[model samples]
Structures are given as structure tokens and as C-alpha cells.
Target: MIRETYVLVERELKKWVGRRGTFFISLITPIAWLALFGKSLNFVNMFSSAGLQGANPVIVKQYVDQTLLRLFGTTNYFAYLATGMFVVFAFFQSVFGGVNIVFEKRLGSMNRLRMTPAPRSSIFLAKMAATLVRTFFYETILLVIAVALGFSVDWNAINFIEAGAAIALLAAGFISIFEAIGFAVDNQEIMFSIVNLINLPLMFASPALFPLQQMPWWLRDIARFNPLTYAVDIVRYNLLGVHSFNILEDWAILIAITAVFVTAGLLASLRVLENY
Candidate 1:
């Protein structure tokens, strides 16, 4: 199983690398957000008004300074945005990977693969492994750029392990949701529209840009129900050492979401196969 999965994963990875345009398009939004939005927004300045509006000027200055200090740590704005960018990349990659299977169906590749003697589970797992591997490469390239621009990372083994686990779980959950969507939808154009329409809203609705405590009441409630919020929180906690919730609870929620999505995706794939 492991060897078969790896072989499929390697093939998909090569395909992804060959599609340079797809990779660049996938990366452009995240890069723009980090380089342009992060610099323009200047989160510190945006929050300054709140502190200044308070009773004491001295207290406001102290509060603003402390908040900025905590938010940025020793790194600059790019590093702060990198956490959000990583989540965005993972979400996009996994969701888009689902549509590839549908495309393969149209191209007759999926039918050919289905005729092979391998277990259906192996086929599903291989696709997922491919998606996860590609997402990791996307993130690694982004991180390399970030580090070149002076993002600081703690090089401890625990941080590396935790980061890898978080990325894997996030990719798995997102890919599962997308795979289910792929099976349910027949029109590729509609699928693309639905995915794009739903993507940015999820980012904005989550605590990706600001802390949940700072969000408006309605958005806060929405974020509470968003699975992406837990993924973002977990990634932020591991990569940036920032915490917006109980660590254990957040990890459990992420894992649970991954499991549910995986089961749903597998069932959907099975049904699609049986129908085909």
C-alpha cells in the first residue's frame, strides 16, 4: 500500500511541477496578501485607534506597544502573514486537487485506473497522498521565500513535527470536502465558481486577518462554526507560537473534522465508482 501510494504521489508531484502556470496562479494570491495586504493594513496601526480612544493616553500607548510586540514577536509583518498564507495555500491546493479526479474522468484516465486490480481504498488514498504532497511543496516554496525575506523559525524538532502534522491534517480535511463536491457536481464550470465564491469568504470569516475577539459579533459566530478556523488556529499555534483557543480542544476539533471529511469523501467516491 505504501509503495503504491508513493508511486502515485510521485507521478502527481511531477505533473504539478510540470504545470508551472498552475503553480504560479495558485501562489499569486497568497504572495499578494503577504507582500501587499500585510504591509498596507499594518495591523498595528489599524488597532491603534481603539487603544487611543480609551481613557488614558499613557495606557493607550502602552497597550498598543504591547499588542504590536506580541503580534509580531521578533519577526516582521511578512512572518505574521506567512501563517495565514500557509493555510490559504493548503485550502486551495486540497480543494483544487479534488477537481483533478473529475477532470481525469472526462479524459478517461480515471476509468482506466479504476479498471486496475488495486483496491478502491488504495486509489483514494493515493490521490489524497498526492494532494497532500503537492500542498507541502507549495508551502515549502512559500516558506523558502519568507525565510529569504527574513522570517525567523525556531529550528527545534518539536516545531518541525508539529508543523508537518498540522499541514497534513489540514490538507486531508480540505481535500475530502472537495472530493465530495467533485462527486456531487457534474459541471466543471459550476464547480469552479462555487469553489472560488466560497474560498475568500472562508478566509475573511475566520481569524486569519485578525483575532476572533476583534471580529464583529456575526463574523465571530461564523468563525466559531468554520472548520478552517480550527486549522488556521492550529497552524498559527505551531508555526508562529500564537494561541487563540485551548490548544488541546483545537487539535481535537481539527482531527475530528479530518476524520468526518475523509469518511464522507470515501463514501462519495465509492458511490461515484459504482455508478460509473
Candidate 2:
């Protein structure tokens, strides 16, 4: 399984690398999101302009930092927002990761692969593995952009590892389901429609773009079941020293949910393949 998966994975990577225009173009969205969204909501400026001008300069500075720290867990809002963006970007990327499978199937590449003696599981695992590689690649770039734009982090190797693990776990869970959808569907339009349907609801309902505390009670309840919520919380805990949920509980819940998703997606994909 490992060897077969490797060969198939190599094919995916080669295709990815060969499409230099696509690879570079794909990066533009995340970069623009990180740049504009990260900088536009300048909370400090908002508060600073709210009438602290006559106060002692040092006192005003301290008050502003303290208020921001109380609300955002950091003196900088960008740091808090950026940490969440890490998870959000990965979430969106993984949601579309399986689109390649739909395309390959449309182009007849999937049919050709099915004719080979390769294990069916290898086809599934190879697509998932390649998606993971792309996810991590984009994540690293997002982190660099976040830091360059005033997103402060722990800067510890352990924090990076923890954040990465959370991202991987989250991506794997999402990729699994979408990959199954890709394999089962005959039309790319259906796969894309499903992606669009779930993408924003999942993102908005979670604490990916805002603090959980700030959400409405019903929304927060919904976010409780969102893997992105746990992912964002875990990433925030590791990177920014602030988080909405307990780390241990977050990990446990995330692991359980991912296990369910992965198991179900695998069974579904294999069952569909059996019809071929």
C-alpha cells in the first residue's frame, strides 16, 4: 500500500509542480486575505481615536494595550486574528483539495488508474497525502505573511509543531469527506456546489474569524461541534498564548471527530470503488 501510494503521490506532485502558473496563482488569494483582512480592522486605531487625546500619553497607551489584551488575549488584534486565519486558510484549502480528483476523473485519468493493479486504497490515500502536502506548504507561507504583518507568536519550535499537528488533523478530516465526495460524484459541478454550500457556514459558525465569546449563544453552540473551532483554539493556544477552549479537551474532541470523518469517508469511497 505504501509503495503504491508513493508512486501515485509522485504523479500528483509532478502535476502540481508542472503547473507553475496555477501554483503561483493559487497563492494570491491567501496572501491578499492575510494582508487586507489582517491590517484593515485596526482596533488600536479605533480605540485611540475614541477620545483619549487629552489624557496623559503614557496612561492612554497603557489603557489601550490593556483593553486590547483583555479582549483579544494579545495587545495586537492582528495577532489574535492571524492565529485564527491560519486555521481558516487551511480549512478552505482542504475543502477544495479533493477537486483534483473530480478533474482527474473527468479527464479519464482516474479510469486509467483504476485499470492498474494498484490497491484502491492507494488511490484514496495518495490524493489525501498530496492534499496534505499542499496544505502545509500554504500554511507555512501564511504564517510568514502573518508574522510580517505584526502577528506575534510564541516563536517556539514546540508551538509550531503543535499548530501544525492541529492543522494536519483538521485537514485530514475535511479532505477525507471531500475526497469521498469527489470519488462518488460523476460531475464536478455537484462536488463544487457541495463545497460552496458547506464552506462559509462552517467558517462563519466557528471562531475562525472571531472570538467564541463574542458569538451569539446559538452560534457558539454550533461552533462547539466545528473542527475548525478546536483547530483555531488549539492553534491560538500554541501560537498566541490565548484560546477559548481547554487544550486537552480540544484535542480529544478533534481526534474523535476526525476519526469518525476518516472512517466514514474511507468506507464510502471504497464502497463506491467496488461498483467499478
Candidate 3:
């Protein structure tokens, strides 16, 4: 099964790499958010322009920086937002992980794949592995861009690995769910509709774009139930020293939820594939 999964994953990655246009185009959205939107939300600059320039500029800067520190755990809002975007970029890629499966199914490749001796579970595992590889590649590029745009982080190796692992698991969880959806559905449009419906709401509802404390109570309640909220907390704590939840608790819940998602999604996809 491991060998079969490896070959299948290689095929998927090779196919993905061949599509140069799509890979580069997929990068534009996160770059825009990190470069333009990330820097634009700086509270220090906002307060500076809001007539606080008349006061001793140093005092005003200190005041705004301190307030931002309290609100975001760092005075550099771009760093806060960039870490969030790291998880979010993985998110967007993971959400689309099953897109190729949908296409393969439609083009008769899925049925062909089932004719092989490879276990149905390997089929799912290969797709998940391949998507994670692709996601991590893009994440590396995005991180480089973030660094160039004034996003700072602890210069520590453990922090880098932990943040990467947190994102990989989070991406795996989402990829499993979407991969099951790909196997279960016949039409590509249904997969797209589901992605569109949940993607933005998930991003907005979590601390991905704003602090959870800044949100209304009802919204905060909803975010508490979101796996993304935990994922972001884990990433932020390791990468930026900014977090809302206990690091250990966040890891526990994230692992529990991701375990459930992976189990359910694999079983469901295998069931659907068996029927075909």
C-alpha cells in the first residue's frame, strides 16, 4: 500500500507541477492579502493619521504601539495578519485538494484507478499526501514573501517546524473532508458550491482576519467551535508569540478534531468508491 500510494502521489504531484499557469495564478490572491491588505490594517499608522500627529510624535507612537500590543499581542499588525494568512493559504489549497479527484472522476480516470489492485484507502491517502506536498511548497513561497514585507518572527528552528506541522495537520483535516466530498459527488459544481459557501465564512469567523476578542460575543461563540480558530492559535503562538488559547489545549483539540475528520473522510470516500 505504501508503494502504491507513493507512485500515485508522484503522479499527482507531477501533474500539478506541469500546470505552471494555475500554480502561479493561485499565488496572486495570498500575495495581495499579505502585501496590500496585511499592511493596510496597521493601527499605528491609522492613529497617526487620525490627528494624533499633533501630540509628541514619539508619545503618540508609543501609545498606539502599546494599545496594539494589548490588542494583538504585537505592535506589528502585519506580522499578526501574515501568520494568519499562512494558515489561510494552506486552507485555500486544502479546500481544493479534491478538485482533481472530481475531474478524474468525470473523465473516467477514477473508474480506471479502481481497476488496479491498490486498496481504496491508498487512493485517498495518495491524494492527501500529494496535496500536502503541494500546499507546503506554496506555504514556503508565501512565507518568503511575508518576510520581505516586514513580517517578523522568532529566529528559532523549533518555531518553524511547529508552525509547519500545525499547518500540515490543519490542511490534512480539510483535505480529507474535501476529498470525501469529491468521491461522494458526481458534479464538479456541487464541490465548488460547497467550497464557496464555507470558505469565506470560515476565514472571517475565526481570528484569521481579526482578533477573537474584537468580535461580538455571538460570533466569538461560533469561532470557539471552529477548528480553524484552534489551528490559527497554534500557528500564531509558535510563529508570532501571539495566541488566544492555551497552546497545549489548542493542540489537544486540533488533534482530536483532525483525527475524527481523517477517520470519517477516509471511510466515507472508500465507501463511495466501492460503489462505483
Candidate 4:
């Protein structure tokens, strides 16, 4: 199984590396998003909307500063927003990760593989592993762009390693879930539609773009069960020293969710073999 997995991983990596244009485009996208949405969005009004009309500037400044510290662990909104983009990108990776399977099935590669002795799980695992590598690379490039854009991502080596691990877990878990959906569904259009439908809601409803406290009661309640919320919290705590939940509990929840999805995805992948 290890050898088979390695072979598939290598093949997938080569395929990915061959797409230089796609790699470059992916690297550019998050930076563009940070520039357009992260830097441009105005959150000042939300802070001042507490009917503090006659409040002194000094009081406002202090209150805002304290609020920022309490919520995001920094007064820099750009940094907070930039770090959250990692979570957004993670979802993007997961959403598209399984499309390759559909393509493989269309190309007859999946059919050929299913006839071989290679474990079906290894094939999907190889794809996930390849995507994990891509996710790490994406994070590294995003961090560089973020720093260039004045996003404070000051973290020690230990925290940086932890962040990377958290991202790996996030990508694996999410990719697996999507692969499960991909395996079950034959129509690529439906998968594409599902991705489009979930992306915006998941991204906005989570703490990735905005603090949970700032959201309405209903949205906050919804975000409480969002895996992206825990993933974002883990990344924020490690990368930006910002945390909204207990680190241990966040990791625990993320891992638990990942385990469930992984199990489901494996079963789905094995079930897909019968179709071929």
C-alpha cells in the first residue's frame, strides 16, 4: 500500500507541477482578494454603531483598541483579515480537490486503476497528500504576500510549525469530505454547483472574515459548529497570536471532525470502485 500510494502521489505531484500557469494563478488569487476585500472593507462603522455618538475621540480610540485586542489580539484589521484568508483558501482547495477524480473517471484513468490491485483508498489518499503539499506551498506564498502587504504575521518557529500542521489537518479533512461527495456524484456540474453554493455561506458564516461576537446570534450559533471556524481559530492563534477559543479544544474538535469525514470519504471511495 505504501509503495502504491507513493507511486500515485508522485504521479499526481508531477501532474500538478506541470501546470505552472495554474500554480501561478492560484498564488495570485489570495493576494488579490486581500488587496480588494481585506484592505478595502470598512469595519469602523460597525465598531462605532453602539450609539456612542458623543463619545470623545480618546475614549473611542481606547475602546476600539481594547476591543480589537480582546477579539483579534491585535489592532491591525488587515493582519487579522489576511490571516483569515488561509481558512478561505483551505475551503477553496477542498472544494476543488475532488474534481480531479471526476476528471480521472472521464479520462478512463479511474477505470484502469480500479482494475489494478492498488487499494482505492490509497488512490484518494494520494490525491489528498498531493493537495496537502499544495496547501503548504500556498500558505507559504500567501504568508510572503501578506507580509509584503504589511500584514503582521509574526510568529516563532514553533507556532509556524503548528500552523502548518493545523492547515494540513484542515486540508486533509476537507478534501476527504469533498472526495466523498465527488465519488458519489457523477455529474461534474452538480459538484461545481455545490462548491459555489457552499463557499460564500461557509466563508462568511465562520470567524474567518469577521469576529463571531460581531455576528448576529443566529449566525454565531451556526458558526459554533463550523469546522472552518476551528480551523481559522487554530491558524489565527498560531500565526497572528489571535484566539477566540481554547487552543486545545479547537484542535480536538478539528481532529474529531476530520476523523469522521475521513472515515466517510474512505467508505465513499470504496463504494465508487463498483461504478468503474
Misplaced by over 4 Å in model 1 are: 1-4, 42-64, 67-77
What is the C-alpha local distance difference test score of each model? 0.76, 0.84, 0.90, 0.82
Select the stronger candidate by TM-score from 2 and 3. Answer: 3
Model 2 residue 75 CA deviation in Å? 1.4
lDDT of 3 by residue, 80-108 (tens): 88989999999999977777788998999
Question: Please, what are the lDDT tens digits per residue for candidate 1 over residues 131-156?
Answer: 88778887888888777656677777
184-267 per-residue lDDT for model 4 (tens digits): 777889888888888889889998878998899999999998888998998888888788999999999999988998888888
**What is the TM-score of candidate 4?**
0.89
- How accurate locally is residue 104 in candidate 1, as Cα lDDT from 0 to 100? 77
> Which ranges in model 2 have alpha carbons more than 4 Å from their true place?
48-60
Per-residue lDDT, model 3, residue 249, is: 94
TM-score: which is higher, 1 or 2?
Answer: 2
Highest-scoring model, lDDT: 3
lDDT of 2 by residue, 210-260 (tens): 787888899989989788999999999998888877899999999998999
Model 3 misses residue 30 by how many Å?
1.1
Candidates sorted by TM-score, best first: 3, 2, 4, 1
Which ranges of candidate 4 are over 4 A from the true structure?
41-67
TM-score of each: 0.85, 0.94, 0.97, 0.89
Best by TM-score: 3
Off by over 4 Å in 3: none
